[model samples]
Target: MNKKAIVTAGLAAALSIGAISTAQAASKEKCYGIAKAGQNDCANISGTHSCAGQSKTDNALDDWKAVKAGTCEEMGGYSKAQAKELLKKQKEMKG
Candidate 1:
């Protein structure tokens, strides 16, 4: 193949791979309190950190990792709403 054709093919393959991964991510849900230390998928709910893999505690209420949709509760992880409510309750009790 010509150089131009090879480059075009490579670009198309990369884009398709990205699209596939995006679709897979769409099927995932953030499961709170499931991440081990430094295993979180993104920033924690408490904002103590602002990046993935920065969680300092295992299974923190504010930390989350992406798990397959519909399997969070089965895995003993809370939804965002549940985590938020629990955090609020914790704060209230502390006061």
Candidate 2:
């Protein structure tokens, strides 16, 4: 294969992989209080950090990870409302 053909093929493959991940994410939902330390998919509810993989505590009520839709409860994860409530209580107790 020529260099141009190889490059085009690689680009096509990369694009397809991106599309696949996007579709997978569309089928996912954020599950709170389940991420291990430094494994969160995004920022926590407490606003301590503004990026992924920044959680300082394992299974922090404020931290979350993406899980398959409808499976978070089975994994003992909390919904956004529940996590928020739990974090609120945790903060109050610490003060």
Candidate 3:
């Protein structure tokens, strides 16, 4: 193939890789589930008490987004794996 065609193909491959990486990152954020949150309340799910001073609704997925990285192993809420993801999602959403 001509240099121009080769360059185009390379660019397309790069773009595809970038898109896949982004999606994978997004999926990782969901690793933390209700099991980690302690309770299904999302807010209470965090063990760090980071959400202590915040309102109840802030932890909602549609609210302020993300959560503080409390105890990833869960204390008052969530399971180990679930809490881990919740913390990640909480941080991502917060930003």
| Candidate that scores best on lDDT | 1
Lowest summed lDDT across 10 adjacent residues in model 3 is found at 58-67
**Residue 89 alpha-carbon offset, candidate 1, angstroms:** 1.1
lDDT of 3 by residue, 1-95 (tens): 89999999999999999999777655542213323222332234444344423434323322122223454324233444555676687799999
For model 3, state the Cα shift of residue 27 in Å.
0.6
Model 3 segments more than 4 A misplaced: 30-95
Please give each candidate's TM-score: 0.88, 0.74, 0.34
* Model 1 per-residue lDDT tens digits across residues 10-76: 9999999999999999999999999999999999888899999999989999999999999999999
Considering every candidate listed, which one attains the maximal TM-score?
1
Instruction: Report the alpha-carbon TM-score of model 3 versus the true structure.
Output: 0.34
Selected candidate, larger lDDT, 1 vs 3: 1
| Backbone clash pairs in model 2 (N, Cα, C under 3 Å; residues 3+ apart or in different chains), count | 0
* lDDT string, candidate 2, 1-95, tens digits: 99999999999999999999999989999999999999999988878899999999899889999999999999999999999998888889999
